[model samples]
Target: MGDVIPAPEAPRIPIIDNDEAAARRFPVRRIYCVGRNFADHAREMGAAAPAGKADRGLPTFFLKPADTIVVDGQVPYPPGTTELHHEVELVVALGADAPPGELAPERAGALVYGYALGLDLTRRDLQAAAKAKGLPWDTGKSFDFAAPVGALVPAAALGDLAGRSIALAVNGEIRQHASLDDLIWSVPEILHELSKLYALRAGDLVFMGTPAGVGPLRPGDSFQATLDGLPPLSGRILPALA
Candidate 1:
């Protein structure tokens, strides 16, 4: 046999159950996202064309590189114009890579490591500017500290998350509410499609999208996201930089 190729390395994050512990470390990689999976959200974001137009087509996909993760306990709002927004979501941690194409629900479950609450922060003004120019959403959606994730809960501890309730609240006011079952494109389907384009690997995380009610944020503001059976994930938004 000739020389063998080395297997690709799996991304990894430190496993912590408390915020204090999580703050001391840096994330292994960052996989940012958008929550266009919800119909109401699609409409709110103008992604849904008029009823008969094209139905907004399909679930849109965008990406942010690995370093965008803000693991330092607090999310520092980026500088510039005011409109910063927050979208809470349920994060899926993969334990192993899945093959491309249609995957059985069971296979998808087997690949999961655990779940956590995550925030997909957006710079609304920048995003709008990009949209107006027909440019990609990178400036608006993939800013530094844009993806703030909570601790991992390990799959063995949290079983099939389908049909579970996921919600988020800001300063005691509920902003986003929905069920995992409401995802237009289910998790397995997402993984299948994503794998076809990029090899699915352990340590890779998916935001799985967010529900409607996405809006702006200001410094000193605090929020919390809760899944039916998981502990509530909370964070405080730091003032925007000068």
Candidate 2:
């Protein structure tokens, strides 16, 4: 027999769902985010919007730990920020089909397992401070319960991508709305770009960025996020610890 190795504890795999198929839990590996993929949102955030395919540059990338996913509906208002913001996005879940590294854009779709709606919650004050000091956005972004996602709907079940709409509402009032076509970088393109950077693999989730109208979220605020035919995600901001 081989030598036995001891470990402190078993790793806890973060899980989402394959829609109502609760028996099949989608274990999350890592969370990859594409920043400013929506031209309107980029402009709103004081960045230049790409006018066409030729002028469109590489997608901005960032990461949030997989455990940040909040599936249970109640999201605690995070600490260290007076300005907490919400950015709803179309999330793409990858399967185990693709070999790691350097995937071509045209063939990237083959790696998709499903899609879901997610909220990319942000601490805007921290983000702005970091930006002013030319620092990384980890403090503003990656935090406890930073990514709240809905169930994953298989890629095979999705209809034409061009026919989808992504929107968000706070307390029943619409704050952001946009057609999927508005994304500067499509899903496949994002995967290809990401694969070039990381060894993109199964259980990876990509937040395809958000549209204009990202705004503040406070305690007791309830929000709803919807993607054309996928499951909608709704959550309430719980009061912060005193």
Candidate 3:
């Protein structure tokens, strides 16, 4: 038997519309992440990402608690790590529950509520150590304020997301840069694959993976990220608490 106590409350993030009016605070139910979904990024990691019509490697995934999300330019430099990395990505929030079974790519848009620019902050050293030991790396990716995001833009207000550039800059210097076209799997394909494995529902946020240049972070460091069709997301790395 487990401890006799009430369950803890799940954290929530405010969803403001980048286009116009603000959105209601979305109760985060779950966070799904896609890993190494870019060819060049894969190569940089010393492996090749599956591609072509015949390539059918199972999609890599991970999860973070909703409490990890932080917004409004306030990202804290977490403790217990010397190497903190920033990964710029397009965050997808689902509007409706995905139908159980294999979902076709055509219907993926119907399930999307909006999009946003998110930084998947990682403790690269801890993550690498975990990988070396064949252990779960959630400790590296799911730390406090690990997901710093910007406003959510309604899907209808956007056009083609592909071919657009997504980049990150630190202290006014560009670090990571890539086009949306570099994604190994499209948003629709990711949604389709996720639905087959997990129970997809409204308020679910999916981190669509990062591009090649993943580097370190320091206290008081400023980070600015821009996804071509989405609003720019910026934040500062706060000093670790005493």
| Candidate 2 lDDT trough over 10 residues, lowest sum | 7-16
User: For residues 123-182, what per-residue lDDT tens digits would candidate 3 score against the true structure?
Assistant: 988998999999999888999899887877778877678678989999999999998887
Work out the TM-score per prediction. Answer: 0.82, 0.91, 0.91
All candidates: CA RMSD in angstroms?
5.7, 3.2, 2.8
Per-residue lDDT tens digits for candidate 2, residues 184-206, read 99998898888788888788899
Error of 2 at 23 (Å): 2.7
Q: Rate the local accuracy (lDDT) of all candidates.
A: 0.73, 0.87, 0.85
Error of 1 at 136 (Å): 0.9
Candidate 3 has which clashing residue pairs, if any?
A: none
Which candidate do you rate higher for TM-score, 1 or 3?
A: 3
Each candidate's number of clashing pairs is 2, 0, 0
Sequence-dependent TM-score of model 3? 0.91
Q: Kindly list the per-residue Cα lDDT of model 1 for residues 61-171, writing each as its tens digit.
A: 778766666544488778765899988888877777676665665577777777777788889898899889998768888877787777677666677777899888888
Worst lDDT window (10 residues) for model 3? 14-23
